[model samples]
Target: MDNSNSNSNSNNSHEGCYFNRLLEYTSDSVEFYPSFKNSTLFTAGTYQIEQGDTEYKERRKGRLYLFDIEKDNKVKELQSIDFNSGILDMKWTHHNNISQQYENDAPLLGVVMSRGELNVYRLNAADQEQGERRLELVCRNDVSLDPSILTLSLDWRTDNKEIVTSYSDGSLALFDVDGGAVTNRWIAHDYEAWICAYNYHNTSMVFSGGDDCKFKVWDTRTIEAEDGGRSNSSGATPIFTKRCDMGVTSIHCHPALENIVAVGSYDECVRIWDLRSMKQPLTQTDSLGGGVWRIKWSPSDNNHLVTACMGGGFHTLSSEDGTFTDLSIKSSYQGPHQSIAYGVDWSYTNSSSTDKQQYIGCCSFYDRCLSVWTP
Candidate 1:
């Protein structure tokens, strides 16, 4: 597909390094552990909260902090740095995003930014803020894999030592954590490749969605280095490509289904595709009003799917037949309705032995707010 018809947003440019929406806060910002047993929400952007026995919060200026939420909802201030690099996405590790070699020591989580920089930091156990636990840079690609990338997704291979990241630049690259280099790179789409995921049930499978309005299923096993690895430097060749309509920003696999995948797009639609029929989506659901940015499959249930959109709203969809119902918490605070929901994660935090409901962690862009929703 030719990108000639694409309209460019200046704020999306990496060279300018200007974020259009900035959240300004007044007064000394108070940090709350949203995961705490007593708190209902956790807010952290300008300040760092270390929740534990001491319960202390350290404030920072001009730095974005990465906080690790424990099972108890306690937030551990993980990493803090001065750079205002727009972190597009981050993935937590079962072992770590970095390597098993460091598992015995400090495991690392991978953070991808809009500036095309990737960083891996050793997660340190903290009771409080000690001098500086600076994040270690395993690899930094000064230039983006896709120059015009609007979104990113990082998923570790079944082995956990390898990570594959998809970009809006219409490309997908697989990196070996130990080698600290990209093992495979494929031009997956014509427009922005928004989101990507690995089929955890099947190790060799992967998927990506983007502005081209297509969701593609790929078999890494058939994909080999394009130059036959004869020159030993040319990247891998994509073995398969499929197309679906409307610029997709999010793509995820059905937690229990083998060949089923779902994608969300700019056309305000969510589509599900089967590998057997790739030309058109098998199922499609319209977004009530907003452009959906992220779609996630519930880790706890195979039939439940969740999505967050740009208009400060979210929805829960039934995977049984692609039917969706609106789901957002009632805000008593009556705060800003412009909170663009950028990130969402499902947690089994408060589940009891007999109860099966899962909690969700959502991050808002405009307000820099993180909210926990129980459903």
Candidate 2:
């Protein structure tokens, strides 16, 4: 396949808008699980191969790579770590006083394993002068749930001490980092809770979506009754609930815009909602042509968002108008032809002041590829 391709819809209002690929990386047989923190990129994946006619075996071992963008606008691999399990998700916490103690130390990284374990790692900046520094495992915690349940998604609080996770068993849990224990756990949905997120402006509240085809909001304070007994009856009731045509696949609260959120569903539409009034969506886009697996709001631009469509490839949606409109940037890989776009994130660093150009990093599942571009 050609490494780069460009095409645009003639009917698209913004026909001149095009996405230029800045970096492309492909793995031989392993898939890439990619995440970004500022200018640095991290990826991990497992290797698998067929053993015989009907049996297959996984190497179990996984590899993690770190890439940093240089002054000349080139990305270079800075470090690699070997792990015993495949990585499902990775997040970097906000820079806080605790993380600022060490000079040149990278932000704390939270790693979610495919087998239901959460590990925190930090870059060892103390020995950079001596030799190549590596990541040090600072803390590890196992989310105690049904053995069959896998942690599907997680979000860190801005304070950097707590993390909220969603599980395959349709449950949500809050974990305390210092205490190394689950602070709270509740059943949030009837089926797999695919996504859970913290409202950045209001940390006490959380939002989650699941295969049950519902988007719900929860308040942590209501976990226990006034008498101190667990409130099993009313505790599970969400502050608000909205049903979609298909399973809700992803949910993201706007980073800067409070009360505004972007919700994606298996129905191939991304709906923008205002928390104040949920009777109807503020605006809904036309069919995006695939299950929207991930939605990321650009840190640089408030009106822009990027979607990882499982079947339609990648798309950039802008809300500068009253409603969200598709920019129709060029995408080389559409689903069913190669693989589904599973992971997508926007880089926080933006050098341009006039033009709203920021780096976007995306990874495809079965294609085992990662690409960075600007739309």
Best by TM-score: 2
Q: To one decimal, what is the Cα RMSD in angstroms of model 2 from the true structure?
A: 7.4
Q: State each candidate's clash count.
A: 4, 0
- Give the per-residue lDDT digits (tens) of candidate 1, residues 133-200: 34455556532543334336676665667777876667777766777767667777776777777875
Instruction: Find the candidate with the highest lDDT and give its number.
Output: 2
lDDT of each: 0.52, 0.63
Poorest 10 consecutive residues of model 1 by lDDT? 25-34
Give a tens-digit lDDT track for model 2, residues 1-375.
232221211121222222222212322111111222334434433332323564221323345555543333344455666555456566666532222322344567777654567888776553657543456789987774543466777777777788888878788888888888777778888898888888776878889999999999888777643222211133577899999998898888876677888999999889888888888888877788889888877665667878888778778787655243333333333322256666777665444333334556666665565455555
